[model samples]
Target: MRLAELSERSGVSTATIKYYLRERLLPPGRRITATQSEYDEEHLRRLRLVRALIQVGRIPVGTAREVLAAVEDDSRDQLSRLGTAVEALPHGPEPDESDPSTAVGRRTATALMRQAGWRFSLGIADEFPAFRMLVGAIAALHRLGYACDLPHLLPYAQQAAQLAVADLDLVEEFTTPAEQVEAAVALTVLYEPVLLSLRRLAEAEESNRRFGGGS
Candidate 1:
């Protein structure tokens, strides 16, 4: 196929294809004439991968190129082992576990981390802002006589993890190994904002359902 056809088929811009060619992310095409070149199916597949990484994964071009090189080196294997390695990349920022304070504060922090589906050791509780926030929220609730039991939160955490894993599996269908890593990065960066916004919207609608229209 020609560059224009490839772009049209892949929903990628011609200029982006040219940029990928210049970056050597896509292999060279056939030289059909002095100026005209013909790209094949492999180029199309590679472009799909590139689009997933750049637009969906949001990877920096330099890092994405390195990831593509890894894919190339591993392309001949019976299994796409490098792709699996890429998907196994960490999804979020690592925690810092250097604090030594203990007692009620630490226990509350640990419980909140549990609620958030984080599986790190208790020693790392001081490192997660979400963990700390959860602790504070639960503590405030308790002081206001609205305390929740840990067991009650456990099921919610489990269900949430199941949903997240399902969501990642769904995204896997359209992504390559490098793009998988990129998508994971993108999910980590954007999911919180998106989910928080949705949560507020849902809460508003539920409030209307419960209190609005004189019902």
Candidate 2:
């Protein structure tokens, strides 16, 4: 299709599309004439991916480019592609290993993972900022008077591991590495809110059943 049609169909402004082209975020279209260019389904798919990463995932352009590069890299295995996608997602600040609170949090996180039998290495955790964020969250919960101990948190980790397996199964449905990466990102970024919303609803229903006057 023409540039206007591509923009219209993708819900991206022509100006932004031009900018993406200039920035090398989106590849150049097939030149039909000296000035006219045609875009195909692949272009549409890539545009959607770029938009999702930037607009929905809130990834910066440079990081988005790197993520795209990783996704498009045919040399990388499925696990590596998945890891790259996870790395590109937003994360909190890295926790200080020397800080007593962070140290406790790391131990708690490590214990939870070990109890759940989740296969992760300390090296992987150290490289991923989100791991630190997870630990920070546990520590913060403890500070906020919540039960952040291993026994209490193990159930959550177990459930998360189950969900991760399901997520991987879904990713396997896509034949191509790019498709798998896109599916992983979309599943993580888009469905996170859906999952949270459902959890909140479940909590409300449970509370109402147990404590509401209707009970």
Top candidate by TM-score = 2
| Residues 71-180, model 1: lDDT tens digits | 56645451344343343322333322343222343476576556675775354555444455555555555555564557765665676678778657855864565445
TM for candidate 2 is 0.89
Candidate 2 ranges beyond 4 A from true positions: 121-123, 213-215
Ten consecutive residues with minimal summed lDDT in candidate 2?
A: 117-126
lDDT of 2 at 128: 74
Top candidate, metric lDDT: 2
Could you give candidate 2's per-residue lDDT for residues 107-138 as a string of tens digits?
A: 89887767776656455775676677889888
Scored by Cα lDDT, where does model 1 land? Answer: 0.63
Q: State each model's CA lDDT, in order.
A: 0.63, 0.82
